[model samples]
Target: MRKVVKYLIVLVVFFMIPICILAHPGRLDANGCHTCRTNCAQYGLQDGQYHCHNGNSSSSSNSSSSNNSYNNVTTRKTTTTRKTTTTTKKQVYGCMDSSAINYNVDATNKDGSCQYEKTETKTEDINYDTKIKGNLKEGNKTVIEEGQKGQKEVTIKSVVDEDGNEISSEVVSEKIIKDPVDEVVEYEEEMSDSEALTILIIYVLNIILVMFYSKKNKNSKLIINYVRRIKIRIIKYIIYIIYFVYVIPVFIDVILVIIDFVKRKLKK
Candidate 1:
């Protein structure tokens, strides 16, 4: 019985040794190849390293996705901030009237830009004509009054450039110094023919009457010589007195009337 048990034990040991060798077929080296141990090769390798690549790659992809999402969010925020920070400049335009000499018709706004030309003034003397007042006969003139020239003050306005050239000028105001006086004159007129004839007839009649009276007195027969002589003297004296009193005044009046008429005609 002991011999038989020994043989059976040896056969059992030999069968167990073949089964172990069949289970592990590869040798142990740097490739990390294993006969009985399962390694990273079952999960796949990364950059030639023995590691659980599936888990690392999956975790890395998730992390990268998270990082990309975070980066996208940050980039979008930065772009929006930049857009909000930027600004545009404003533009303005207008016209300035204070410095300009002439009025501008087209400018819509005032910018305080304007230009002006130079200006000047001048003065001069003036003479005025005389005015006539009274009358004189045709073809006759006399200065009843004298005339004198008057003076005037004048102001001139002018625009000049920087070159000392005149642009334009105008009168600003005028004044008087002394007014002139007008002259007056007059002349006489001749008496009419009818008026002369009437005076002559009256003079001749008076002469005839005086002569007749004297002769009558000289030839008187009834009166005494002394009485006749006295009467004759008295008569002659009365005749002379009447002629002087009436005729002299009438002649003076006629002369005055003629002068007045001539003056009035000249006035007209």
Candidate 2:
């Protein structure tokens, strides 16, 4: 009976070893854990549940690692979306011309609101007035002072197109750079000594001739009366010519000289 019992125990041990080896069909992970796909109740676990023979199980670790991976992927996606949004932002619009008054430095597009300005120098000729200083011969003139033109600076504000073509402009300010100078002229009308002497000699010759003619013709009353009448007519003609030519011109010159003197006094 003892021999038969020993042989039966050995056969039972061999059968139990194969049954324990084939109990779990899935392979183990690095943590010696696997999912219970079949015969879960035999190992005290639910179907598709993760378990481990070691004390530390991979269930919580794997869940946390998956959560972290998900968070990292979500963060990367969010960062990528932000970068794309920043890169595709709308462009700013304003005046892009550097010479404009309303130029914008941060603008990417031109909206035509630019206002431009420029400084222009302009010269205007101020006509010089002539001032007569003294009396002159009827057809003679002499310059005493020269005349000059004036200059001014003008600041202008303008509205222009993108191509620098002016659309509208207005004068902002003006300043005179140079003042005009007036022209001064002088004239004189004076008779020479030689001319006066010549007139005196002619008068003396005429008087002597009249006296001689009167004395020679005195014997006859009618002849003396006729000679006296001719002498008077000739004297009157000479006096009239002298008065008309010399006296009238001298009188006019004196009047002009008085007028110029009066004007100068008033200005002073």
Colliding residue pairs in candidate 1: 95-111, 99-114, 99-115, 100-114, 100-115, 144-184
Single out the weakest 10-residue window by summed lDDT for candidate 2.
69-78
Tens-place lDDT per residue, model 1, 73-164, is 10000112344576775444343454557545566665544444544343444554444444523444555666556666667766654345
Clashing pairs in 2: 135-187, 135-188, 136-188
- Give the best candidate by lDDT: 2
Question: What is candidate 2's lDDT per residue for 1-268, written digit by digit as tens?
Answer: 9999999999999889966764666786787666668875555455666655444434243321122112211000011234444467579999998877889999999897787765565655556677788656543567889877677777777777666788788888888878878888877554444654555456556556655664676454564355557757877576556534634554555456555545555868
Superposed on all Cα atoms, the candidates' RMSDs to the truth, in angstroms, are 21.4, 14.3
The alpha-carbon deviation from the true structure for residue 148 of candidate 2, after best TM-score superposition, in angstroms, is: 13
TM-score of each candidate structure, all chains considered together: 0.26, 0.28
Q: By TM-score, how accurate is candidate 2?
A: 0.28
Q: Tell how far residue 68 is off in model 1, in angstroms.
A: 14
